[model samples]
Target: MTSPSDAPEGTEPGTEPGTEPGTEPGTVRPGGRTARVRAAVLEAAGDMLAEQGFHGLDLAEVARRAEVGKTTVYRRWGTVAGLVADLLTDMAEQSLPRAETGSLEGDLLANARLVRRTLSDPRQGPLFRAVIAAATGDARTAEALHRFYEVRVAEWAPCVREAVERGELPAGTDAAEVVRAVSAPLYYRLLTTDAPLDEDAARRAAAAAVAAARAGAFVRTP
Candidate 1:
């Protein structure tokens, strides 16, 4: 008979490798062996996505690189789309919190800089491009991508709300829209041009969002 430790890479008798003991198979725990396996898998997935784009992402390859069992990867993520969805979810969870700069400008600038830095990062930049490209033709991937942005926007929307409370912007300002405005140009520039994402570009993006907000452009209609 096999011992618990010898059950398998993903199966430990009492607990699943990627999920908590006695919990649902797909439920993610915060830490422990499960978390470590998840981290390893995600890291491998991101690396592959960065190096060869979505088409090159293979579950077996990811398991091999992560030193986990292929069975584990398949059981946890199921498909390439599933893996990418989990990857995006992990990215959103691990992303930086909203900046608490006293003024709205300061907060927007910080948000803009963070976005620029992420898009300009060697690994992150390529990973994002690959995911975005993958989403273009895949409905599931597109939904996951949209959820990823929604999570990010929700994280920063509070800053805009605070600005409104401070009377920096008009009442009924759509905080989500304001946050989106700050990131839109940076993403556009990243996808549309070969230009460097310099500090100036970040500042400009933040300034433009603030200007628009102050001018009541993001105000919601009754």
Candidate 2:
């Protein structure tokens, strides 16, 4: 959600990024000039969110910062919520894929460390805090945030499934819950405490989740 570059010239304006010429906007396949515009606009939006928060996000300012036409921004993104939602979508799409470390503990630790790094990053951390704060009072932003996490959680769920297959965890372990468990304490610490998210913290979170899953804490009961 944090990086964006300038849009190149010579493409049709106002078309959504990554949309095909003959297709509807949301049908969305990536290419060409529109992607550049999207990149620029999203970058501007992210910067603004990090600097000024959701209340400070202005479409005109975003358009000016991105060097994109104001009309194009209005036409494509419509509202602040829409723009923020797209930013989340882009972030999810740009995020790293799941780690395949061949063991539940390794994969969960990787997941924990990734969360720590992201939540600890200067730009990303503030951006997340702003979005999360905005989401508390905004339904659209909340939905977008939920979707973003859903995508991420789904990406890592397989590690728990694999652990179950290997009999390292009980049968019917709730894979998503196990994955969430690995990250929950980290987020709680991020929001509730002033402690450092060191590697040791990541390791501890992963270890605790693994222990819990092995104890059937995350097993689905009928």
Candidate 3:
């Protein structure tokens, strides 16, 4: 996934090009060699995370796998947590945009299906699980993960607002809440059971969110 790099076009904004201290995950993407290095490092890091979990992630190993110098990896991302946080930011930037299907049900169904596909993907599924598991104990990782979802929710919130305008949902239906509701069940299934995230499940998730939303279950409260 393409992440927002903290650098101007064709230049990395850090102590030494792509080194850390001032480099945040989302600012501007770097260009040329710096961009390639970042991409390679993150790609290698993701593969290792999917295969070895957080505890097994090593900066030296990541550098070796990415074919970059270990010193570069250490300088850019000082700690494992820092690297993971950047990885989450990259994922957020790479996520798909929300669907605009006109009807709430249609839109939510599309959302549910997208979640299903991502959560069920061979590579992404495990990667997400590993990151989520790591987030439970690491504060930085959790914050970065929150940012990822915030970006996605913000992207999809407009559909709920549009539905309100069309009278498909209540006037004050919590758009973000409704959007979250659409995916909650699918995520629950993914995390709790070995159930397949099939078309029927996606339909059910969308239908339930639509039903609850139409009934004002997601209305904002004090």
Alpha carbon lDDT of residue 131, candidate 3? 90
Q: Over the stretch 81-116, how does candidate 3's per-residue lDDT look in tens digits?
A: 888888888888888888877788888999999999
For residue 157, give model 3's deviation from the true position in Å: 0.7
For model 1, residues 57-103, the per-residue Cα lDDT tens digits are: 99999999999988778767778888898889899989999999899
Better-scoring candidate (lDDT), 2 or 3:
2
- How far residue 67's Cα lies from its native spot in candidate 1, in Å, is 0.8
RMSD of each: 3.1, 5.4, 5.2
In Å, residue 140's CA in model 2 sits off its true spot by: 0.7
Query: What are the lDDT scores of the predictions, listed in order?
Result: 0.89, 0.86, 0.84
After superposition, which runs of candidate 3 have C-alpha atoms over 4 Å from their true positions?
A: 1-14, 18-28
Q: What ranges in model 2 sit over 4 Å off?
A: 1-30
Sorting all predicted structures by lDDT, with the top scorer first, yields: 1, 2, 3
Which stretches of candidate 1 lie above 4 Å from their native place? Answer: 1-15, 18-27
Which wins on lDDT, candidate 1 or candidate 3?
Answer: 1
